[model samples]
Target chain A: MAYWLQQILNALQLSSIYALIALGYTMVYGIINLINFAHGDVFMVGSFCCFMAAAFLGLSFLPALLLSMIGSAFLGVAIERLAYKPLRQAPRVSAIITALGVGIFIENFTLSLAPYPKVIPPLLKNITWALGGVTFSSLQLIIILLSIGLMFFLDYIVYRTPVGMAMRAISWDKTYVPLMGVPVDFIISITFALGAGLAGAAGTMYGLAYPVIDPYMGIMVGWKAFIAAVVGGIGNIRGAVIGSFILGTVEIMVVAFFPSTYRDFVAFTLLLLLIIIRPYGILGKPRTQKV
Target chain B: MNMHRDILLEVRDLQVSYGHIKAVKGVSFTVRRGEIVTLIGANGAGKSSILKAISGLIPYTGHILFNNQDLQKIPAHKIVDLGISQVPEGRGIFGNLTVQENLRLAAWQRGDKQEIATDYDRVYTTFPQLKERCHQLGETLSGGEQQMLAVGRALMSRAKLVLLDEPSMGLSPLLVREIFKVIAEINLNGATILLVEQNANMALRLASRAYVLETGSVIMSGGGKLLSDPRVRAAYLGA
Candidate 1:
């Protein structure tokens, strides 16, 4: 029972991180219909930024986290302007290829600069509490709480705010939104920035918990978060969160019970099965064609 | 309302070609202030192409001047800023946005908060059904309601001139009449309207001046009453 409880807590912590990054993917895909392959690299950049801010600037943990988020967001906007904006009117295939190129570029650039993996400083490594024989680190608690808070905040912005309404409008029909006098391109850029900022926050938190940072950290996490986005329903907020938790829990449980080496295969196989069974995803509405 | 002033919109020798096909060729027309003009034609007669060209959605070689300013160089969104709003074919409402949100988006460029609030209430008053479904997503609305939302959205832009492209398309006969009635009301409330329709009879009835487009050019241009001529009746009205 104690072992099970620990596994559950572990799954929840991992799931929370996945959910944070997945939100970024899902939100960008929702409005622009682009996969933003560089999104993962943006996450990796966030971890590096946090590390630099803490080590070089001697900033405390919280300020470093905030600086990391701002830095990643700026990088995201730059990526969009430099890589994605020029191809806004280009074919989807071209945009997808460009995004992939950006991902590769960022990873290689980071590898060239850092050249070696670095350990994340143990800022919140203190074990604060043990509930039901399951120890919880302060970082774990912060990660869980921060992820939930951000998700709720995103929900409110999407459902209650005017900008959220404009995003939904643009996603549904881009041409019509412009005719309505809403600057469609500006709204799209803002969406990218917001998603990037969230990914940055997630990256910072992930680094703190794991205590290891690498230039290529974003690739696997990005793939898993993308899978989570797909499983939840690519454009649905609640769907992404639900999908992340499911993916995280199942991954942890599989590794806990079975061979850890089979974890990737099992998770991917489940995603493939879900796709074949329900292509629109668990929460996505079926697109109807006009006759 | 100032008829003595310069022309509000002028299209001189407009020519639009799609690949090897000429959709609109040497089409010329003028819209004066506060006038309700209609362009009536058959399905392939290029009525929509002209509107699309004027709104800068399609590239065309033409001298399109609005208030003595050239419009061929501007993009579609900039054209809206120039005070020409198009309620395009099929009532292009943002299906996922709520009615109020749709209206708010239309008023995005306008910074007058009080005026926007007043306009919101005015739109609600103009279409009570829209007010009842203010918070409802556009897709959930019926076809008629969607059409109302489209027109209401256009009005929210506070445009000086509105280009309506087949507003009556796919609507029930009753809804079609209601839509035309709203168009007339909109004109009465002070916006210049340039309407295009396949239904020549309805177009002739609602408009003061009418242009008959056949194939890719205007075959005839006269007062709305003259649209009942024998040739127009046979070609466009299928008499």
Candidate 2:
């Protein structure tokens, strides 16, 4: 019972990070229908930014996290405007290729700056609590609570606010939205900024937990988050969060029961099975093809 | 001179193209204040393209003046701020949004909260059925309800000129009559209208002055009397 509770806690921690990154994927895909393959690299950049702000600039934990988020938001907007905006009218395949190319560029650009993986100096007081044979760390508590708060904030923005209404409206019929007096381009940029900012926050938390940062770290985490988004329903925000938790639980349980080597194999198999059964993912509704 | 001042919209030698296929070739026309002006034509006659260009949906060369302001200089979203709203082809309502949500979104550029609230009430008053289904998703609404929502959304913008494209398409005859009645009533309430329609009989009946487009050019322009022209009757009115 204790071991199961421990695994559940680990699953929640991992799922929070995945949920944050998955939101970036889902929001971009919802509006423009592009997968935004470069998103994982943006997460990596956020980690690196947080590391630098904390270690080199002598900033505290909260300030460094904010800086990382701001930096990532800028990078996200820049990537969209420079790489994706011009291809807005181009074929879908072209945009996909461009997103891949941008991802590669970001990965390499960060590598050139820091050739080796850097360890983040611990900023938070390392305090572990033991209660009835179950261990809890402050880092774990902070990450889970912060992630839940962010998700709720995002839900409020997407469902309750006017800008959120405009975003949802654009995803439905982009061409007609402008005629209703919405600045569609500006709204798209804002979406990217919001997604990247969340990814940045996740990066800071991930760095604090693991304490190691590298240029390519975002790649694997990014892909898993993408899977979560797809499983949840690529465009549904609530679905992304639910999918991430499911993925995290599966991964944690697989590692706990079997050889750690088989973890990815079992997780990917589950994703494939889900896809075969429900191609549009759990919460996704099939869309009619428009002429 | 009095007539010239009354011209609310004037298009001069406007042209639009898509990959070397000139969709609208030097089409010129005028919409006067307090009149329902229409551009009538068959399929592939560039009627929709003209409306799109006027609303800045597509790139075009030549001059379009709306309320004496050059439309060529304005972007599509800003065109709505200038009080020109287009219903667009096929009643472009957001399927995922609710009726009330759709109406509120159309007023995105307006700042007068009181006026906007009144407009919402006015839309519900004009189409009481819309009020009944205010919370229902747009796609679930029937064809006639969708058309009404589209027009009702246009009205929410508080536009001086509303551009409607094929408002009668896919609707039953009874519903079409109902929509036309609302259109005429909208005109009576002091909004100038520019209607684009393939249904010439209905288009001519609703419009005070009309322009006939053929092969991307305005082939003829006149008052409602054009409905009597044998060529128009035979070509458009099904002689």
Candidate 3:
């Protein structure tokens, strides 16, 4: 039972990071039907932002997180406006190719700047607590609480607020929203900013937990978070959170029981099985095309 | 009172084409302030296209002047902010949003916080059924209720000129009468309306002036008495 509890805490820590990044993917996809394949790299840029804030500027946890979020949000908006907006009316394949290209460009650009992996200086003092033989760190608690807080805040922004209403309306039907005088383009940009900001927060937390950061780090993590977004249902907010937790649990358990080498294989197998089982995803509804 | 009424919207040699297919071909018309003017036509006669052009949704060659401002310079959302609201064809309600959300979204561009609150009450009073189902998702509402929500949304935008496209589409006759009554009420309360409809009998009865379109151009333009004209009666009124 103690061993299981420790594993659950590990899962929560990993899942929180996954949830933040997956939300960015799902949100951008929801507002505009683009996958925004470059999202993972945005997460990579976020960690570098955090690295600069913590290692060089000597900022603490909250400031570093905000700086990272602010930086990535701007990057996300720029990516959408420069790369994605022009192709809004283009063929789906063209937009998708552009997205993949943007991801590659972001990765290569970062690679050229930072050739070696850099370790993030500890932003939070190291503290550990053991409860009933289940050991946990203060960083883990912060990660869990902060992620849940941000998710709730995002939920409020999307569901309760007037801006959120416009976002939901835009997501539902792009046509005729402008007639209501809701600036569709502005709302879409806001969506990108919100999503990227969440991913930035995730990057900062992940960097703190892992300590080592590199340009190529976001690739595998990005793919995994995307899988979480898909498994949760690509457009649904609640589904993304649920999907992340499930992915985190599966990955942690696989490593906890079997060899660490089995982690990616098992995690990917789950995604394949999930697709075959739930094609529209766990919470996704199979939409009928209106004639 | 001045004999010459103020023109709220004017279209001059307006042309709309979707790639090679010309939708609205050189249609020119004027809507005076505080009057309901309707465009009646067959299925492909380009009624909706004209509305689309005026709302800045589509690219148009000709000039549209709303309140003496050139419409070509404005974007679609900006057009709405400038006080023209289009209650679109198919009653484009967001199915995921609730009735209240659907209504609230219309008032989004405006900063008149106090007036918006009063307007919500007015809309609720105008359509009590909407007030009753304020929290219900739009898809749950019946066709008639959805139409009501659509019109209510247009009203929420505080538009000076309300362009209604096929407002009576897909509703029962009784419901159509109720919705038309609301439109009439809305116009009487101080809104200039440009309406497009296939249901000519109801539209003609409500319109202060009506234009008949066959292919794209207006074949006849006159007042309510045009309902009795042999051409309008034969083509539209089903007489």
Candidate 4:
């Protein structure tokens, strides 16, 4: 029981990061139906932003986190406007190719600037707590709790607010929404901002936990989060969170029971099996084309 | 032929094209205030295209002046701010949204809270069925109910000029009558209506004036009683 509880805690910590990055993938896909391949690099930028703030600016943990999030949000919006906006009317293949190119550009750009991985200095003092034979760290608690808080805040914005209503409306029919006097371009920018901001938060948390920052870190993590979004349902919010936790648990359990090297193999096989079983994903509703 | 009447919308030599196929070829018309002006035509006659241009949905050449302001200067969103709303063909409701949300979205530009609330009441009063199904997803509504919701949404925006493209499309005869009655009521309440329809018989009955469009041009024009004209009867009324 204690072993299981510890594994669950581990799952939650990993899931928090995955869920954050997955939301960025899901949101960009939901509104524009573009995969936004650069989303992972945005996550990478977040970590570096936090590191720069803490190391150079000499800011504390909270301020550094905020700066990273805000910086990432602006970067996301800039990417959408400068890179994706002109391609809005282009073929789906063109837009997708452009996304891949953008991702590569960000990765290479970051690699050029920082050729070596930098250690993130410990901002939070290490404190461990054991409850009923289940040991946990303060960083784990903060990551889990903050992920939940951000998710709830995102949920409120997407479901309750006027801007959220416009987002949902745009997702339904991009052509007709502007007729209602809603600024479609501006709303899309907001969506990008929110999604990237969440990714920034995730990047900061991951850096704190692992204590290493690199330009290429987002490559693998972003892919995993994207898979989580697909498993949950690409366009569904609640599903992304559920999917991340499932992926996190499965990855941890696979390592515990089997060779650690089998981690990616088993995780990906499960995702493939799920796709074969349910092509539209867990929460995705099959759309009926109207004549 | 009263030139002194209050003109709310004027389209002069307007032309629209898709690729190389010109959909609206130098079509011109006027919608006077306080009147139901209709354009009746066959499938490819560019009736809907003209409305699309007026509402800034597509790029067009020539001039469209809504209240004497050039429509070329307006974007699709700003067209609504100018008090012109189009219930585009196929009742473009946001299917995932609840009926009330659909109505509220139409009021996107309105900032006055109290007035918006009263407009909600007015929509509910006009379409009581919409009121009952306000919380239901838009796609769940019956065809007639959806039409009502579409019109209700147009009204929610405080539209002075409502451009309706085939409100009677795919509806049963009884439901069509209900929709037409509501259109008349909406007009009586001081909203100018520009209706486009294939159902010439019903459209002629409701319109104060009518234009006959044939293959992207206005071929004929007259008062509502033009239904009696032998040319109209032969071509449109199917005499």
- Candidate 3 segments whose C-alpha is farther than 4 A from its true place: B1-5
Q: Give the lowest summed-lDDT range of ten residues in model 1 chain B.
A: B1-10
lDDT of 2 by residue, B1-239 (tens): 99999999999999999999999889888999999999999999999999999999999999999879898878899999999999989888898889998998999998788998999999999899999999999989988899999999999998999999999999999899888898899899999999999999998988999999999999999999998999999999999
| Best-first order by DockQ | 3, 4, 2, 1
| Candidate 4 Cα errors over 4 Å, as ranges | B1-5
Residues B1-239 of candidate 1: C-alpha lDDT, one tens digit per residue: 35537468899999999999999989999988888899988898898889888888789997999988899888777889989999988888877788988888788778898998999998888889999999998889998898898899888888999999998888899999998999999999899999999877888889988888889998888887756699989876889
lDDT of 1 at A200: 91
Could you tell which candidate, 1 or 2, scores higher by DockQ?
2
- Each candidate's B-chain TM-score, in sequence, is 0.95, 0.98, 0.97, 0.97
TM-score of model number 2: 0.97
Stretch of 10 with least lDDT, candidate 1 chain A: A119-128
Tell me the tens digit of each residue's lDDT in model 2 across A1-291: 988899999999999999999999999999999999999999999898899998899898889989999999999999999999999989999999999999999999999999999998887887999877789899999999999999999999988777888999988879889999999999999999999999999999999999888988999999999999999999888999988999999999999999999988999899989988999999988999442
Clashing pairs in 4: none
Candidate 1: tens digits of C-alpha lDDT, residues A158-207:
87777787888777767666676667777887788888888998999988
Worst 10 residues of 3 chain A by lDDT: A282-291
Computed on alpha carbons, the lDDT of every model, listed in order, comes to 0.87, 0.92, 0.93, 0.92
- TM-scores for all predictions: 0.94, 0.97, 0.98, 0.98
Clashes in model 3: which pairs?
none
Instruction: Give the per-residue lDDT digits (tens) of candidate 3, residues A56-138.
Output: 89999999999999999999999999999999999989999999999999999998989999999999997999888999999
TM-score of 3: 0.98
Using Cα atoms, each model's DockQ against the true complex is 0.63, 0.78, 0.86, 0.80
Over the stretch A1-291, how does candidate 4's per-residue lDDT look in tens digits?
Answer: 998989989989999999999999998998999998899999999999888888889888899899999999999999999999999999988999999899999999999999999888887887999999999999899999999999999999998877888898888878889778888999999999999999999989899998788899999999999999999989888889988998999999988789989999999999989988988779987889664
